[model samples]
Target: MPRMNDVGGQDGFGPVIEELDEPPFHADWEAHVMAMNRALIGQGVYNLDEFRDAVERTMSHESSYYENWFRAIQTLLKERGVV
Candidate 1:
């Protein structure tokens, strides 16, 4: 079965908007989340595949992009007993 995050080729979600000149992040917390994800990956806390799996496991349709990443990190850390 497809995961919740797997919406590719589906319908009713509307088209994706391309924001020209979009900032690297919309908020400070998103940057922090990115940094944390990088640190965790660099430290061998989780591999890229594991991180993606965690994200898919915790996927929510209402969440924004970085929000999903943040949630996935939380789930991974907790599952690994690192937090």
Candidate 2:
């Protein structure tokens, strides 16, 4: 089954708005989360597939992109006894 984050063909979610000249991040914490994800992956704490799986598993329809990522990181770390 498709996960909540998999909103490919399903509708009712509305259109995705493209922000002109959008910044890479909306908040410092979002950037930190991205950096942490990179660091953890670089250290071989978990591979990309593992991280993606965690993200998909923990994601909700209401979460923003970075919020989902942050939750995924936490979930993965906790499952691996790293947190």
Best by lDDT: 1
What's the CA error at residue 33 for candidate 2, in Å?
0.5
What's the C-alpha lDDT at position 67 in model 2? 95
Range of the 10 consecutive residues with the lowest summed lDDT in candidate 2: 2-11
**How close to the true structure is residue 20 of candidate 2, measured as C-alpha lDDT?**
98
Q: Which candidate number would show the highest TM-score if scored against the true structure?
A: 2
Cα lDDT of model 2 by residue, 1-83, tens digit:
87777877887988788999999999999999999999999999999999999989899879999999999999999999999
Q: Against the correct fold, how does model 1 do in TM-score?
A: 0.91
List per-prediction Cα lDDT, in the order shown.
0.94, 0.93
lDDT for predicted candidate 2 compared with the true structure: 0.93
List, residue by residue over 1-83, the lDDT tens digit for candidate 1: 99998887899997778999999999999999999999999999999999999999898989999999999999999999999
Off by over 4 Å in 1: none
Each prediction's total of clashing residue pairs, residues at least 3 apart in sequence or on different chains, is 0, 0
